[model samples]
Target: MVKGALLAMGVLGAGMLPAFGPCLAAGLPDTPLDRARVLLVVQELEITLLTHPSATLALEAWCATHHMADRPVVVARKMTLPPADPVPGRVRADLGASATQPIRHRQVQLVCGTHVLSVADNWYVPDRLTAQMNAALDGTDAAFGHVVAPLHFSRDRLEFARLWSPWPGGGQGAGGMITPPAAIVRQRAVLRDTHGRPFSEVVETYTDQTLAFMPAVDADYAH
Candidate 1:
């Protein structure tokens, strides 16, 4: 399960904390380190949904009912050739669904350098995680406006510093002498809504460790 994978990555936490000061000041929820992790999970769910036959059928039925079968959507994948070949490639899927025989999946082949990649048997995905992902996608879309505020606040509070540097600048001065200075960098959080609006905002400060959140959002109130 995706939740299990997240748990393995240490995303859940002990309890809910109070919302104080600025939204960014509140700190991240005991969740993954950043939005990237969430996005990867979302992508995986989307792939699963797209590949599952049952899920495809459902989406096809919906598309047909809505009369939106002619729309063209694009999907992509990266590919690498065997060591002996040294070629690179990609695969792209163009899909359209409708009320009648909705869900037409196509495969395209790409060749680059000395490599080739192929995509085939376009289908629907119907996993439990896909349903959860759909819900999360919906929630993200509904809360699009408010999400950025907290992310920005968090970045201001968390910072990191580098420990090592070369002394006297250029080429290790005088008998390999080295100097180190305390360098500070801040942690930033980013998120994206369903419409694909990139939210590059900082929300809170964090230690070099894992955090988690319990019931991160109230599903009843999300919509």
Candidate 2:
């Protein structure tokens, strides 16, 4: 009965802290620290997703944890790869190839209901993947990691950065500058096949949409 009630409320899974349920049911992250706290949550979530077997399911689990499992959507917008750009030096080194390598690019926006959780730029080698896998990527909304799961892949995160542009913090001296709506969490990673050859390079940016339901920080709260 209790479990059914929780499920009805859109809170599923074992990790949904009952104590934090109210916290999850609140407004967007407004203050700088509130955004930072939510970033911490999302960073941990991303770390788990990177290593998970099925990244699509991992994303769904994350959405459930944040009370967004009812309607999940990953709108994968295919993009034409230029001869240059987003092909960072690390990606080349990880792939053991130069920028000349044939790679397909796509941008994805993972939305839960009306909120956009993340936007990812994906660059993958079609040569390394099966024809069916490539077809699934072109035709489905499944994540690249899921489409390539047959490779039994592993991931190496190259970078993680916090973007605090319009809002830096209180004592940080804004100099009367206007603050932006929210912050961003950026990550760069390479996905490797079982034999440890990198087949994909992904850069995911978690936008302010992720902050849509984060809790507000208390003014007197000390970090």
Top candidate when judged by TM-score against the true structure: 2
Model 2, span 1-223: residue lDDT tens: 0111111111111111111122231343345655465446556665756656444556666666666546654445443334544444555666677678877766665556666555566768888899999999988877776678789887787766665432344222243322233334566678889998888877665555554444432232344
Question: Would you estimate the TM-scores of all the predictions?
Answer: 0.15, 0.64
Least lDDT summed over 10 consecutive residues: which range in candidate 2? 1-10
| Top candidate, metric lDDT | 2
**Any residue pairs clashing in model 2, and if so which?**
none
Give lDDT tens digits, candidate 1, residues 77-117: 22222244210111011112122322211112111111111
TM-score of 1: 0.15
Q: Candidate 1: misplaced stretches above 4 Å?
A: 1-28, 31-51, 54-72, 85-223
